[model samples]
Target: MSTADTTDNAVRELLLVMPRLVGRVKRLPLPEQLRSLDLAPRHLSMLSLLLLDGPLTVSQLAGMLGVAPTTVSLIVSDLSRKGVLVRREDDADRRRRIIDISPDSRPAIAQWLSPGARAWRHALAPLSPAQQRIFVDTLLRYEAAVSTPTRTAPRRG
Candidate 1:
């Protein structure tokens, strides 16, 4: 077999695997502890975004989530009810409230995320130390690329 054919086959394999990886990421139970809390999907999304991006204004959240500002407000209200989010008045603009993650939820986030971390550790454990490092590094890069805001195109529906 020609070298170019091998390269093409490898690329095809990666294309096939990409969707499976994405499906798994979307299914992660990052807030399992609060699942019985019966929080809305939008509320949990707001908390996860804050955990990733730090505190942000409602406008920023709207932009990141590709939803209207009012939609973000509704989500924030739910999160507050769930005790996962808090409202902070912006000092520079007292009329504008900045949403922030609740301090109590931080520990919960860490604890809930530990399982995924351990899973990755186990998955990569069989590789040699150098190979494991490279594999882990590649996964980090893939995560950053996948999670970047620009990667989420607006839904047509």
Candidate 2:
């Protein structure tokens, strides 16, 4: 097969598999504490970052999340109110607040999120650092393409 054919085949397989993969992830059980908070995708992203990177400031989270500081603050505030997150003074910078998962809620959040993390580790373990970078970059490009709006051609009668 030509290179074009190979690329098209890979794309076709990904299109078929992506939805099922997302569906399985969505079906993962939410812990009882989190279930009542009415969490959204944004919340999941924030929580995942904290779980992986430890505590971070609102500006740092906003930069990573591609959102404004106010937006991150709102999310932090809401999660804090729900007992899922905590904000404390940053030791290095007395004025800055560091956000992290609350001790009370950490286990539940870990329980809910760890399975997916482990699955990713398993899938990526065999890859060399370069291969992992390529894989991550490809997914980032795919996300950008899907997120951008496109105009469709007009139809004729």
TM-score of each: 0.56, 0.95
lDDT top scorer: 2
Ten residues in sequence with the least summed lDDT for candidate 2: 30-39
Give the clash total for candidate 2: 0
- Give the deviation of candidate 2 from the true structure as CA RMSD: 1.2
Each model's lDDT: 0.79, 0.96
The weakest ten consecutive residues by lDDT in model 1 span 109-118
Candidate 2: C-alpha lDDT: 0.96
Query: Per-residue lDDT of 1-157 in model 1, one digit per residue for the tens?
Result: 9999998998799889989986886677756666676665566566667776788999999998889999999888877887878899999999889888789877787566555567767888889999988987987896798798775678897
Residue range 1-157, candidate 2, lDDT tens digits: 9999999999999999999999999999999877889999999999999999999999999999999999999999999999899999999999999999999999999999999999999999999999999999999999999999999999999
Clashing pairs for model 1 are none
Strongest candidate by TM-score:
2
Compute the lDDT of residue 107 as modeled in candidate 1: 79
